[model samples]
Target: MAILPRSQRLALAAQASARPVSVPAPITGWNARDALDEMPATDAVLLDNWYPDYSGCAVRNGFVLYSTGVDSSPVRTLAEYNAGATRRFLAAAGGKFYDISIAGAAGAPLASGFASDAWQTVPFLSRLYFCNGIDTVQVFNGSSFASASFTGASSLAFIGCIQYQNRLFFWLPNATGFYYAPLNSISGALAFFDLAAFAPHGGNLTAAVTFSHDGGNGVVDFVAFILSSGDCLIYSGNDPSNVNAWSLVGIYRISPPVSPRAVCQYGAEAFITTYDDHIPLQQQLVALKLGQLPPRSKVSTAVQNAVRANLTGFGWQALYYPRGRRLIFNIPNADGTFSQHVQNTALQTQPWCRFTNMNAYCWGLFRDNLYFGAAGGVVYQADSGNLDNIGPVAADARQAWNTFTDPMRKRITAVRPMIQAVSGETVSFGLGFDYGDINIALSPTTAGAGSPWDISPWDTSPWSPDAIVDPRWRVGGGTGQSIGVRMTASANAPTVWLRTDFRFEQGAAL
Candidate 1:
């Protein structure tokens, strides 16, 4: 693998007049989408769960993060084995905080803690709601917790439940229907909404619940839930008549080996996740993109069609979209490596993957690389050429002709000469800056044709004269700002003897 001289490569870039290549600015950002600042002390490690909150990144403080086991319990908090980290916290019955993070090993006590036995779930909010049993429900506020009493009625005990919009709902194991509360609304103090009329038969217990805004169009909102039997159900939020009712719009029966975990709705499409263990670990991606909801049906076939169409391929999983960037997907390979792909490109292609010993599970996008949390509390970053396709590359190409205001200073758009790799043995590029100045850099890659070699005429004119300057052009106006050379690629040409450099600048000046 011989390295090509930058001079020769410069010429090759311009051999063609019609086919021009424009480099893209790379995609760059931070790591860990759900990274928490001011993490708790190491000794006091607790179970962590990410919930959808309206306030962007402010789900903590106001909400309680709990731990299931105690460090003192030998069996529960053994020194080895992930520090006994399988903790689960949920809004449990009787407003008690269910500490499920501890390992219920032999000879280990439940671990002593404040209000552990007195409260079933911790009080993270002013009001608490949970299912006491099948056909029984309870609501407890500060008053209820103090008095050890509830004001709601008992309804069918739900096998599983979740709360949204301040109302809690549950499902019956049989899936025949759903029972909602407060079962007994005595006077006006307690409230109850009977959704028995809206329940769908054969609907198993829902394992997950999520909602999606209607893409900000005010068309309709969405409610999606996954059942234990691996079935998915979706409903439209536009039915003003049945505000609490959910119409079964559509269903997907994924059988034989895939367990769906997360569900997200984008626009009118629903993305479902399947657990995988392939080389790079496959995440079975299934989508449902919608066209229009059915007239009288609870579920919309339009939505189902959209999902099925998007899930047309296997071995694809859509990561949660990064806040500032477009949708970048992780395409997994057989060797535990993955590439990030941009859906916005016509070349909806995935990046190339090269294994680097351990797997690179992308936690976040940084500058031009993906950052991963390694096995032993160490962090690693990887560059898979994802940046070459976007970000800095594109910005670099655009900067050649457009005026780039120093991002740190005032809003001054400066343009310069477009760097064009010239013809000859020693090919060089002329960079015209928006300020009428010229600069150059060697192309590190390929060196092209046209063999005269000497391009001295192109180099000395650092800034072109005013008479020849295009009236539309303006003078570049800054010192710290880039007015000259940026980057260059070159190659060796035996016949011609010359070294060349290319430069980009704002536009011609005034």
Candidate 2:
């Protein structure tokens, strides 16, 4: 039997009473809403702790202890400061902000004494600004951190802030209005851009973002305001102070945004994390009068139904990691656990996978690396290695069950998972027949030290006799017409899942 490796197509190797079915790693990614047999072969029924790469490739997501050992707590907000030639990363916990740019027992808090720790920060004009609508706004200019007190800044207590059209834009938390400072001025006089008169549904302002669009004329910047009732007010203009220049484009409604940071910049466009959908700003802007959704982006279609139930949960965020070509959507569970629905934006199909062991409360990018703030008052850098600082990275994937060749009861004789080798690493695997649950235990093997150059294998061996995975054919026990491959694996190095080979014997057709 010969197994051919194609893009995502299955290569069959038929032998006497044997069916060698090559199951490729699902680029169609995680599907929790669809039926077992109704999904494509490239879709996963259960995928966790696995980070999908460009192709149908995945590596066990790993993170080391970037910063920890302060008071045990949850790092709810991760903030970044961008200086012209350098960058600074900060974390918020226990009503204080710490300099997490360096990895260690987080040094003395950069700024403290806040009633609330959940802050929204943005870098503008070579400084980092912080706001939460509870306390006075603060600013950090690489060295000094203090309350921003300008001529008219004492009354500027907004929940969020962003730099749009060479100006500082802010939105009031419980008011259906927004305030904008003068062009390129972070201080001095502030102008109120009231949306309460424009909001048809009439709810408090939730967030504000600057959206860039082309309407057959040229590129223009539209100031977008999101309301608690899902009313979105889009306006086109650079200056809001000039009444004639600022015009209300339209007021459309969408799902209520999770937070002020629900919208993330994605290259020329942006993505909004709504309660029920991951809507693209450009595509949404191009829609009809009501800003209806267009053809599915398939970005979060598979798992959105499950995510809808947890819309009210805290710690929801959307981040676009340009360095990793990823769009990570952090989901908060009712049980306090967190999982990320990651989309590989590099791929045209935009395959998505669920990542376990990444209990991220907030996300930030600095120095072109991905970092997440989680519990324990710690911030960890992702994609660092194969092992997590919190614990071992346990990956589990259940392929879509399907009846191959003929619809007949068959016995799964044996199965072999073709995994890319990383010297000597342990791999625990098990099988699930029909829709049964699968449990795979850990049995680690000692790592192998590569042989020295020009060293003879017969004369010298790296270490002791190790019963490594070898990924040899293991005995599989399953008796059903539809079969699925269940694997749980982890390593300290990059791991690629090519495909799984199945050997089966057909029995009664009925």
Candidate 3:
């Protein structure tokens, strides 16, 4: 009886198709199945003309702006705005404050009281509240504008604003605190009646927002404060009037070097990009859910080094699209453009993807539509159509499998890749042997046209299911002690890799 060589078992565990700073060992099952340069998904088309130096973005009262002028622009502008009574899309631009809701008419300058380029707007009680920490908060009740008597700290500027629980909250950065005004207050006072004291951090207030989570018993609302020193304080309970009613549910820390404005709530968690203490010198994209404590796991490790190398600075912006369950982070890239790190939470297993071309500076979701303002004054509707910025869609994924080691030399007989290609799409495969020293391409497969219901041919075959495909490709002859595989797809067509199988036979050891 002859002794036989031992067979080995190995597989690539499911992981985000991330581009790591350095590739892991061939045995580490977490290597990305896609390349770093290839976008995680298809590219989106540009929806409007360029609006140079696009700055802030917001969606309210059923209007979306393709671009808003930066602070320095002569008319800190918006393409359109709606006053309550008008059905016309008003073009508002010019002066410190402008109203643009009149049809076919140039926007008129708003009240001159507002400070130049320092406004943050929020919608509540059928009115749009515009606040600049340097001036009194302004309100537009659809048809007209008025100023509210803000009875906060004297000269306390309102840097940010949000609406929660039928109340309007404003971030008083100058005071290093926040104050709220009840929407139904009888006195019509916009006063800092309730102060959100952050005594623990000693006041480095940067940004604040509200989020809600399912806290076992029921849904609970929490206010999150982001400080310049990287500490995040989350408080529970709706009313800030009663100090005891608010409880500190969690105190988490993010990278100290982060833009104060770079936080957004998605589902029950908030996502931010900042330096990771564990991996010094690298910025990590992290997620913090309610009740999840510090030492948060880094979700962007696969691309941490890439992110650190490409970031122009700490300026970042983030937003969540609930309809798509996607969390998008926009960071200025080294080349002046922006890199959008998109995370699809619904796909838990493979959640991260990168997008470019839009170079979005900010994002807003209005009326269930996603809009982003990019450089050169361009605005885009994400995932709107096939083309990207009116150009060809460039999409690809590079997958590397774990090394298949054998006690003796092995001759690879067959390689079978299970892939699902969208109809009218084609996907290509590539193979690498001996730690990818040698690479070869396999036969490309073009998916067949799926069954059509419009055709009148009664004698028709059953619809071709996506799962049924002949992925087996013969690799005539090759002997290797260890083998690996790399697969790629480059086209507008979408493809998904289900799995891959290999067959080999024992041979003489090298």
The most accurate candidate by TM-score is: 2
Top-lDDT candidate index: 2
Q: What does candidate 1's lDDT look like per residue over 1-510, in tens digits?
A: 987788867545433221222222111111111112221111001111111121111000111111222222111001101113222322121223223323231122222222211111111224443332332333334222222232343434434444433334455444533433332321122334333344343345444344544446764544445554444455554332365754555554332112121233344444443322111111121322333321211112222332344433222333334342233333334444443332221112211111122232323322323333222222233322212212211111111222233322222232222222222212222233333444444122222322322245533432222112111222223432322323222211111111111222222333
Supply candidate 3's per-residue lDDT for 219.
Answer: 79
For candidate 2, lDDT tens digit of each residue in 325-405? 888888887677888888888887677777877888888887888888888887888977668875667777887776775
Superposed on all Cα atoms, model 3 deviates from the true structure by an RMSD in Å of 10.8
- lDDT of every predicted structure (CA atoms): 0.28, 0.72, 0.47
Could you tell me which residue pairs clash in candidate 2? 73-377
Q: Write the per-residue lDDT of candidate 3 for residues 1-510, one digit (tens) a residue.
A: 864444321222111221112122111112233342222211111101111011100000112234343222332222223345532221122225443332222344455544534355666655676655666666666566677655644553676777766777777654556677755541244555322354345446666667666648887776766666666676776566766865777666665434444566665555556554121111121235443434422234534654576644522666677776666666666666665665545543323445556555556554455665444333445655444645534433333323243456665556665544446555555555554543436656554443422233312423234423444444524666645444444434333444455666666666
Which segments of model 2 are wrong by more than 4 Å?
Answer: 1-15, 69-72, 150-154, 215-217, 285-312, 405-408, 438-471, 506-509
TM-score against native, each model: 0.31, 0.85, 0.63
Q: Give the number of colliding residue pairs in candidate 1.
A: 83
Where model 1 places Cα greater than 4 Å from the true spot, the runs are 1-163, 168-209, 212-219, 227-231, 236-246, 249-260, 265-270, 274-322, 328-373, 378-510
TM-score of 3: 0.63
Segments of candidate 3 deviating more than 4 angstroms: 1-121, 130-140, 143-149, 173-175, 182-203, 213-217, 238-241, 244-257, 277-298, 302-315, 348-350, 404-426, 433-488, 493-510
